[model samples]
Target: MNREFIEKLENNPVIAAVKDDKGLEKALKTECEIIFILYGDICNISDIVERIKSAGKVAMVHMDLIAGLGSGKDVAVDYIKNTVKADGIITTKGSLIERANQLGMYTVLRYFVIDSMALVNIEKQDRHGIAQPDVIEILPGIVQPKIIKKINSISKVPVIAGGLISDREDVMNALNNGVLAVSSTNEAVWEL
Candidate 1:
């Protein structure tokens, strides 16, 4: 993990998480504040890192989909440190956050809140075991203003709204509710 890159994202509010090479180009053209490259898509981590540096944008690796880490905590931590060179990590597990802190990497914990029950459970769990991350990516499934506020209330870390967000209104709704920024695979929202 690169401390400098993590600092860059913390400083910049908006970021674009691009899915492919095309999306990378689009994100660059859009002048997104930061760019996240999925670790699975990377055949050459060094090349990608160089491109990101050359473009003057913060680059992070998305390791949530990695085979081992997707299943459990131990493998997740191993892959997080060994498989990618990123400013930080994007994961859901509380254990991973703790491990990232140990590795001296910034953590971006993602929570998929499908309903109010899940939100409540997350808040409860957050209180006891998890160390606060540098950022939390909240995927509320449906972009509800109330849900956004609910997440904001419990989390001290900066909130980033993601998943199923389709337009500027949804983005505005998220931001209005206290999310520091938003992320999407959609190019339209990527421009925002």
Candidate 2:
């Protein structure tokens, strides 16, 4: 991860995760320093990213959620780097995380921790050092303080609490528990 970018995240712990054009517009007008785009296609992803940049904020695309990008990691990474010019990318695939790191783009490896097995897998992945993403995003962050603490204890990478963060308290709870930041699609929460 870029140290400067990470610092920005630290200073502003609330990240706007937008899923549509309306969300993007609201995000652009908010106090958010980072925007995680969960919706877009090949035809408009670049435009959206550019718009975010023009507003002096960072834009991160969720590679897996983007339509028309297919499943090829290399192609998507290349496009995101060269065309979209996004500040970074968020993905659930370890391979893509590695590839994005190689391309010098910031990466957030998202993990949906629903059980002990998932927690064990995250530990194993961190230990093996196969795909060390710049940041690890734990989903359903609204109710996983223990899980978040566990991941933080074992991993050297910064953790981002994402998904289901609906209010200021949710954002504060994640940050108070040791996450570097919180990613939320809730426009109202972005101000926090």
Most accurate candidate by lDDT = 2
In TM-score terms, candidate 2 sits at 0.96
Give a tens-digit lDDT track for model 1, residues 141-169: 24677777777788666678778777888
Evaluated at residue 98, the lDDT of candidate 2 is 84
- Once fitted onto the true fold, the runs of candidate 2 whose alpha carbons sit more than 4 angstroms away are none
What's the residue-level lDDT of 131 in candidate 2? 76
Clashing pairs in 2: none
- Residue range with the least summed lDDT across 10 consecutive positions in model 2: 139-148
Error of 2 at 7 (Å): 1.0
* Candidate 1 TM-score, C-alpha based: 0.80
Candidate number of the best TM-score: 2
